[model samples]
Target: MKPRICYTVWFSQRNRSTLLCEGLTATGIAGKPAELLELPPATSLLDFYQVNDYAALQAKLWQQRMTENGVFGMKANAPRKESDPIIGQLAKLSGLKVAAPTPYAVWENAFPNGKHIFLTRRNKIRQAVSWWKAIVTGQWHLEKGGERKVDSQVISQHYNFEAIKHLLLEISLRESKIQAFLEEGNIVPLTVVYEDFVKQYQQSIRSVIDFLGITDTQYPIKEPHYERLADELSDQWVERFRIQLQKDWKNVIW
Candidate 1:
């Protein structure tokens, strides 16, 4: 029997997980076509299966994903809560592979046998600024061929550095949590930085394909068509907030 690739990506919020997944799905793996399965937040296996009893349903869903080619890809963003019945079920579930979303520690426990891909952003300041902006605007992703609206009032005139500072703290803690899990598990993941992936999609995607043992001789490798959500305010806000954190917090590292 030929071996099938089962993998999951552990990412932080605002790190371009969607873009990466789309690219990965484009490349054909073996004789099997790939599909990116996404799990919603706060929903569990029971909710996902849509049944009060799910032992059989879980297996059915898993078998469905496996398809004819036997190659499967699935991703989930870490749920908001630390521990949930659904999350625990996902971690322990057999047969289905897990995929992307930020907050990887929980999923790490859930899918121990699955391949781990760690996608991250190098610029903490920029990531923090982007995350802060999204929280206020409630706009996380931009649609294809859609225009991005920047709120100058909230971004420029009345920007909240204190709130941003706290948000940065949260981001750092999450990153550290993922790092600790990696170390404890002794798992060396296929690490892709957001900036590098943006600059070199082919190389980045190729690295991932290689990791998964996917061979594509005819697939046309292209960069994702999505537009960035952040703008000038994102850069300026990050710079100003960094300086403020240095002065007020004494460059606190928590």
Candidate 2:
């Protein structure tokens, strides 16, 4: 039986997920290269507002799998707090494992048998700014035009300075989750830092190939175009936001 690979992305928006997904597709795991969202056909006209029922949705996905000739990949943002339990139950019924980035330690704990992969970025402030841009431009989500009210208390709770530091914390948490899995010897997970993955794409891909137990004779990993932000935000603004984020990050974690 062919190995089934499900990639779980944990970032907010506009991160390097597209490049990673494209890379997997080019290597033939996805059969044909396309963005992550291209998988699992649209189930309803209301999909923009919400997802269809889990069991029915998975049934549709399983049906689609009959025609594909390689490992399957499905991507989604963080599961909604309310829907998580149902999704977990459905995954149990379908024999699928959840794959996602490192910061999902809490969620990973909930799905103890799930597989995990961590992707970290070097410049988090740039990432945050990019996330903001994607949100504003309607690429991440549709935002209605208005003066967006910034909740000072909420911002204080989750913001972190030096975006890289936040990235590191996320990495640390993911490493912890990986260690837990290792200690139990139930699953062996893979970790990929964004910088290292980019610098040594082939090596990273080989590591993933080994972890997934893919045959060397069959699917080989490929590199795809990793798009970078064309222009960076002003240093002064970045610094200011960084300070705010630092305070919030500290509050939430420590």
Candidate 3:
């Protein structure tokens, strides 16, 4: 029997999805929505997921990530562009003859009949800074009770202004493209804001529960599983990025 997929939460970098997915899993009714089909680090899309194909992905999920209740949830980072590696990853593994590059098209076999959730961060510069920091440090998320420390080598000389700026553009462009995809598909996703969710986590989880329309009693809410990485250095980069933006462009920050 085919496993039922309840929804696919779409996002990009630095949206704090790890924490939110933890919260949602705690709810028990949402099932465990894990990034089961993600592209591996340091591997290009064309180079991976081809041999195993889509059946392998499902088998992997059923054996590991899928819940016993027959409710499955998944998450995917929105493609930065049509040419994004993720599209190729999905298309090849999908084992379907999907010509389009968007995830919705490639995962049509797995995506349809599932709801959509779009997560976004309100602060673009901060998100970009976080993305670049993680890329440089090779530490995307910190587990709960983990020390919020940046690598010593990274802070001294790894701060590249242009790299962060380029990431900011990538983040922004991908967001625009995702919005269009949702609009074109007439898909209304439950949009969650990172800052607001962090401020009122319990309430935010409740909102997600309500969106899922589940009547089961939720498990006791607990402290978030992941810690935020934003620090003084993060702030410093944000301000520096803004200053550079002002110096290079006109009326951008006013």
lDDT for each residue of candidate 3 in 1-254, tens digit (9 for 90 to 100):
35555677788889988888888877666778778656568775334534345566555544454556655677777655657655555566544664654556665554545677899999988999999888877788888778746654467467788998899898888778778767766789999999998999999888877787666664667788887888878888888878877885756753
> Which one wins on TM-score?
3
Candidate 2 total steric clashes: 8
lDDT, candidates in the order shown: 0.64, 0.46, 0.73
Rank by TM-score, descending?
3, 1, 2
| Tens-digit lDDT track of model 1 for 110-131 | 3333566788888877887888
Which residues of candidate 1, in runs, are more than 4 Å off?
1-3, 30-43, 52-54, 60-68, 77-84, 91-113, 151-154, 248-254
lDDT ranking, best first: 3, 1, 2
Q: For every candidate structure, what is the RMSD over all alpha carbons to the true structure, in angstroms?
A: 5.6, 9.6, 3.8
Runs in model 2 with CA error above 4 Å? 1-12, 30-59, 63-70, 82-114, 139-188, 218-223, 234-236, 243-254
User: Which should have the higher TM-score, number 1 or number 3?
Assistant: 3
Please estimate how well model 3 matches the true structure, expressed as its whole-model Cα lDDT. Answer: 0.73
After TM-score superposition, what is the CA distance of residue 121 in candidate 3 from its true location, in Å? 0.6
Separate clash counts for every candidate: 5, 8, 0
Tell me how far the alpha carbon of residue 101 in candidate 2 is from the true structure, in angstroms, after superposition: 23
- Once fitted onto the true fold, the runs of candidate 3 whose alpha carbons sit more than 4 angstroms away are 1-5, 40-64, 80-106, 151-157, 248-252
